[model samples]
Target: MAPPRNSAVKSARPVLAPLSIGNATPSNGGTPFRKPILTKAQRKAAPASGGIRRYQKSTELLIPKESFKRVVTSTVSDASKAHPMRIGKEALESLQEAAENRLVKTFEAAQLLAIHAKRQEIQQEDMKMIRRYQKSTELLIPAAPFERVVRELAQDLMSDILFTKDALKAIHVEAEDVLVKIFEKAQAFAIHAKRVTITDKDIQLAVKEILQ
Candidate 1:
C-alpha cells in the first residue's frame, strides 16, 4: 500500500547537520589569516596611513631668474652710459642664488620670531622689530646719504613710474629696514655655523636648512 501524501512529503525533506564551532572554516578559504608585524626601524620609516601629514621642505628655487636679473641690471647699470651693463651667466646665477638664500634666511628668522610669540602667522611688526633690534646694536649710517642712494636706485629700477618724495622716502626706509633684518639673519647663520666671517656658502646653507 502507498504512504499518505503528507507523510511522503515530510519524508522527502532533507535534514541539516549541526554546525561545528571549533572546526568551522571561513567561506573565503580554509587558510587562517595573520597580520605581518614590522620591526621598530621599519615602523618608524613607514608613512602614516591617516591624519594630516607633516610639512616637507622644497628643494626648488622660489624666485624667477629673469625678474631677478632685470632688477640686478637696473641696480648696477650706469645711467650715463648708452648701453646697459652686461652680466656674465655665472655672475647672474651666483647673484640670483645669493639673493634667494638671503630672502629664505630672512623668512626663516621672521617665522621663528612668530613661533616664539605663539603665532601661526608672521606680522610686519615682527619684521620691524627685527630691524629695530639690529639697528640698535650696529653703528648707524647717515640716513640722508643712504636715503638719497636708495632713491636713485628706486628711480633707476622703475624709470617709467614717477615717485613722489614721500614715496621715495618710504622706499628708502623700507629698503634699509629689510637690509638690516637680512644682515642680522646672515650674522646668526654665521655664528650658528661657528664661523667668524659670514660667507655666501653660509647663507646658502641657511636656505637649504629652511627649504631642503
Candidate 2:
C-alpha cells in the first residue's frame, strides 16, 4: 500500500518559543505580574527588533563559538572563580622596571626651564612641539641640583640651554669665591704645619683631589 496521501506535506518540527515578558508566568513561585497595558500603537510596534516569527526560526544566539567561550569563561570565573590567570614574577618585575623608567623620563622632562614651569621638558629627539604641549602637572626643578642652576640662569635663557665657556666661567667664578674662603682656613692650618710654600697650587691640587 502507498504511504498516506497527506505524507506529501512536511511534518511540523518542534520550535523553541520566544520568551514573553508581558505574558510570562513567574518561575520563582511569585504570582505573575499582570500583562503590561500597551497602547494599540505600542502593541503594534515590536518589542523584539526582529519579528517573533523570525526569532522562532532560529534558536541559536547570534554569537560566535569563541565569543561564547570567552563569555562562559568570564562568567564561570566570576561565579566559581575556579581558574585564575596568574602573572609571573618576572613579568611583574619587568612591568615595575618599565614604570620606573617612564617616571625617570617624566621627571627629566619636567626639569627643562622652558618646560619646568609646565613640568614637561621638550627634547629635540622627541621633536614635540612646545606650543602643542600644555602645562598639566607641577614642573618642579630637582631641588639641590636645580636650585643654584635656575637662580643663576634667570639672567640668560642660553644658560639653561648650551653649556657655553662663559657659563662654565660663571660656575668657576662661583667656585673660586668658595675656594677663597676655604683657602683662608687652610692658611691658618698651614701656619700650624710650618709650611709657607704651600701656595694656591697646593690649594688647587688639594681642592682638585678632594673634589675628585
Candidate 3:
C-alpha cells in the first residue's frame, strides 16, 4: 500500500521573536501605546512637576466663612428681636453679601473722597458728607420721633405744648438741616486741628458758634 507525498507534507509554524524593551511594539496596531502613570513621589521627580499630583486649594479667602456666618446669625437675631420673624439660610446669606458689598463701597468712597481732598488719610469727616456716599435716599429723622424728643426737651423750658403732625414734620426737616450744618462746622474744626476724628471739644465749639 502506497501513501500520497502531499499527505505527508507538514505546515511550517511561525516563531515569535523575543521582545526587547527598546524595540518592543504593541500587539494591536489600532490602539495607541500609553506611558506608565507615576505615583506622587515619582511625579515630583518628573521634569514637569505635578504631572500626576492631586489638586488642592492653594489659599483661603480674606474673610473667613465661619466668621461671616456668625456675623449673619447675629444680625438676624438682632433684627428678629424687633420684627419677630424667622430668616431662612438663603435670606441670611443674601443679607451678608449685601452688607459686605455696602462696606466695600463705603471704603472705596472714602478713598475717593480722600484723593479729591488731597488728603493721605480718610477721616470721619469724609464719611459725614452725603456726596461722598452717593446715597440716593436722604437721611432724615421721622416726625414722630422728632416730636417726642422736642416734647421731652420742652419740659426743662416750657410745658403744655401740643404740636400738629405737619408742624412736627417741618421742625424735623429744619432740625436735620441745622444738625448737618453743625456737623460740617465740627468737621472744619477737626481739619484745623489736623485730626481725622472730630473731638467733643470741636463739637462743643461748633454748637456754641451756631447758637451765638
Candidate 4:
C-alpha cells in the first residue's frame, strides 16, 4: 500500500532551521551600513543646515554671516522708513539673497584685486575698487571739498587739533562711506515718490532715518 499523497508531499518538503539572533544575516550578501567618519577639519567646518557646503583652504570667511545679515536687516529697515512701504516675507528673502550674492561677488572681485597686487592677504585698499561707485553725477562731491568739510568737523569736535595726512585720509574715507549709504537710501525715497530728481528733503529724511 502506497502512502497517502498528502503524507508523501509533506515528507518531500525541506524543514527550515530556526535563526539565532547572533547568526542571523540579511537575505542579500551586502554588509550593514555604518556612519561615516569625519576628519577634524570637516567636523569644525560643518554647517548647521547640512544643505550645501562651501570649502575654503583658508580658515577665514570673506564676510561674517551674522554681520551680513544685520546689514541686510538694517538696509531693509532704512528702505521701509524712507518709502513708508512694507516689505513682504518673499521680498525680504529676496533682498537677503541678493545681498548675499553681492557680498560673494564683492569678495571675489576683491580677491582678484589682491592677486593683482601680489598680496596673499586681502586688505581694505584691495576692496576699494569693488566698493567705489557713483550713484548720481549731480551728487558727486569733489574730493577736496569733502576733505575740507571733514577737517572742519574734526576741528570742531577736537578743539582745532592738528590732523595728520593718514588721519585726514581715514576721516575722508569714513565720511564717504556714510554719505554713499545715505545717498543710496535717498534714491529709494525718490523712486518711492515717483520722481526723477532727488530733493534735499529726500536726502535729509534718508540721513535722519539711517542715523536713528
Candidate 5:
C-alpha cells in the first residue's frame, strides 16, 4: 500500500521554472536581452573598422558577355547562310574563355618584345612585331634604336625601381631567347592547324600549348 521508493525520490527533487523573456530584467537596469541595432551612420562606419568586413578579388568578366554573345551569333548567322543558331550557355562561356586567353597571349607576346629590347613599356612597334613574327618565319626585328627606347621605357615603367645597365642587358637577352621559343611554337601550331596563314588564334593556341 506504500508508494514506491522511486516515486518518493522523484517528488523530493527540486523543480526549476522555465525562463521567460518578458519576466527577465538586466543586471544594470538596461534593456533585457536583445540584439544591438545600428544607426545609419554606425552601419556606414562599420565596414571601415569592423572585423566582420571581408574583401575578395573581382569576379567580373573581362569581356562583356552580352556583347560577345551577340558578335558570336552574328558571325555564325553569316557563316551558315543566315540560319538560326542557338549557342548554349556552356559553349558561350568556353568561347569567351578562349577569346580572353587569346587576348592575354597577345599582350604577353608584346610585353616580351618590349622587354627583349630592354624596354619596360610596351610600344606600338612591339605589338606590330609580335603580329609579324607570328605570321611568318622571317627574321623579325624592331626598327627602333634598341638602347634608347629600352632606357626610356624602362624609366617610364619603373620610375621607382632601380635597374643596373648590365641587369637591363641581361634581361633583354633572356627575353629575346624566350621570344624565339614562343615564335617557333606558334609556327608549329599554325602548321598543325593546316593553315598557311598564322592567325591570332594559332598564336593563342600555341601559347596555351607551350604553357601547358
Candidate 6:
C-alpha cells in the first residue's frame, strides 16, 4: 500500500552554514555591522510573518567560524608591530654619553632643543601680554581712549608673543579699534565687512592718527 500524502506534512529544510564578509579587530563592546545573506533554503522557507528569526537571537559575533579566528590574530599582531619605537638600553646609554661629552649640538639634537625652548618662551610672552593689557585698562582715561590703547597693545603683543599668526594680529587689533570708536560715537557698530588688511604703513598711519 502507498502512504497517503497530506498538505500539512512538510519536510524539514536543510540548514546551510553561514558565510563571513571581512575580518576586523575586536573591541570592548564589539560593534561589527554586516549585511547578511539568506541561504537558498532559508529564503524559500520564508517565515509566515517574514521576520528574520536569526537576527533576534544576537546582534554580535555573527561572522563565520574561519574568519573569527583570523580577525583576532590580525588585530593582536598589528597592535604589537605599530607600538612606539623604544630607545633600547644600548641606544639610551649611548645618547646619554654623547650628551655629556659633546659641547656642540648635532642637527637632530639641536632641532629638539630649539623647539622646546621656543615653546617655553611663547608661554612667558603670553603672560606678559595679559599683564600689559591689564595696565592699559587700569589707566585713568575715557572709555574710548582706554579701549584704543588696549586694542593696539594686544595686537602688538600677539605678534611678539606668538599667540596668533604674527601677520593677522595687527589686523585684529585695528578692526577692534575701529569697531570700538564707531560704537562710542554712533551708539551702534558698523556691520563688519571682512577686515581691511593693514600693512606696516597702515599700522604706522593708525598710530600717528590716534597718538597725535
The 0-to-1 C-alpha lDDT of every candidate, in the order given, reads: 0.69, 0.52, 0.69, 0.68, 0.71, 0.46
* Ranked candidates, highest lDDT first: 5, 3, 1, 4, 2, 6
TM-score, per-candidate, Cα-based: 0.36, 0.18, 0.37, 0.34, 0.35, 0.15
Q: Which residue pairs clash in candidate 6?
A: none
TM-score pick, better of 2 and 3: 3
User: 1-212, model 4: which lDDT tens digit per residue?
Assistant: 99657877878889774443444434444444446899997876564443323343444445565675677667777878866655566775666667666877677567656766776668988666556742233324666787788778877899757877787667767767798789778867885786656799999999999899
- Could you tell me which 10 consecutive residues in candidate 4 have the lowest summed lDDT? 50-59
Q: Once superposed on the true structure, which residue ranges of model 6 sit more than 4 Å away at CA? A: 1-51, 57-60, 82-212
Ranking by TM-score: 3, 1, 5, 4, 2, 6
Cα deviation of 115 in candidate 3 (Å)?
Answer: 11
CA lDDT for candidate 2: 0.52
Model 4's TM-score against the true structure: 0.34
> Residue by residue across 13-87, what tens digits does model 5's lDDT show?
887644346766554454466778999977764645333223124444578899999999989888888477788
Q: Say which candidate scores most in TM-score.
A: 3
Better of 2 and 5 by TM-score: 5
Pairwise lDDT winner, candidates 3 and 5: 5
Number of backbone collisions per candidate, in order? 0, 1, 0, 0, 0, 0
Which pairs clash in model 4? none
Can you write out model 1's per-residue Cα lDDT over 1-212, one digit (the tens) per residue?
99657877987899764443455446434444446889997886575635212322455556778888788887778563666568898998988878888777677678778767887679998899777865674435665787677667767888775657787666666666666666666777875775656799767665565444
Maximum-lDDT candidate: 5
Which of candidates 1 and 4 is the stronger one according to TM-score? 1
Local lDDT at 17 for model 6: 35
State residue 97's C-alpha deviation in candidate 2, in Å. 58
Model 4: per-residue Cα lDDT at residue 201: 99
The ten-residue window of minimal lDDT in model 1 covers 49-58
